[model samples]
Target: AADRVYLLAHGKVEKVGEGPYGAETVLEVLADGAYFGDQALVDGDATWSYTARAATACTVLVLTRQDVLNLAERAGSLRGHLDALASIPEQRTNKYGEAAIELSAGHVGEAVVPHTFVDYELSPREYELSVAQTVLKVHSRVADLY
Candidate 1:
């Protein structure tokens, strides 16, 4: 799926996710001028964990990953803001965005705890889809014969 950032320009949107027993839970209700998918700008391959549904008739401003990056390149403040948002996941959480816990189980007394750190993929795989079409010109006689 093509993930793009959405800015709520008008109306309302309900951000929802699957809850226990497969129930639909409302994560948040966004009003006009709210933005979702900021994380998409940072991680191109990241999949959305939640879904956004229209609460009412809405108008949204959409920005693709490339669009946001291009804007960030020309705007120094925006580039800094995006960088700060990108670093948040690495600073306090594991790759899964969960709290990092250090535990040593089944260890003998006086054994030093092994050091570990979260390692991220330097070059993650990115997939892009493209389409090609051919236009064929058939003669009137050829078309009738077929």
Candidate 2:
């Protein structure tokens, strides 16, 4: 039930979840620069399926859901990046975050193999650079006084 995304800046973190038999299981061990609660970026109502605990003394950076939306509005690149990330289908990735391949093995008869393709982004994330300019004006009388 995390309302914000957490980025582990230093130390280690353990993602724990409950097993079917009411046992606590360690789902993943996250290291520095790892991201947790990232589903909040795409789904506003998303909740953490697992709990994160610090394995060691850790420094975490947190960003609320509204903070991401506000930043996305200001930066087109970030919006596009988030959109691309959200567009990835869950079925395409495995639990280890690797590409999943569908295969049929030891079939009695001929089986139809599932066809899958890797989705690639045609346009990668790009940033828009902004510049500011100012003009200083002075009167002739002011210059004479100086």
> In order, what lDDT does every prediction score?
0.80, 0.84
lDDT of 2 by residue, 1-146 (tens): 56799999999999999865779999889998888998899877887888899999999999998999999999999999999978876666765566887765443665666887876778975748698678856545447788
Instruction: Report the CA-based lDDT of candidate 1 relative to the real structure.
Output: 0.80
lDDT, candidate 1, 58-96, per-residue tens: 999999999889999999999998888777755566644
Candidate 1 worst ten-residue window by lDDT: 103-112
Candidate 1: TM-score?
A: 0.58
- Candidate 1's displacement at residue 43, Å, is 1.3
Candidate 2: 10-residue stretch with minimal lDDT: 104-113
Q: Report the Cα lDDT for residue 46, model 1.
A: 75
Off by over 4 Å in 1: 90-146
TM-scores for all candidates: the values are: 0.58, 0.65
Instruction: Highest TM-score: give the candidate number.
Output: 2
RMSD for all candidates, in order, please. Answer: 23.6, 23.2
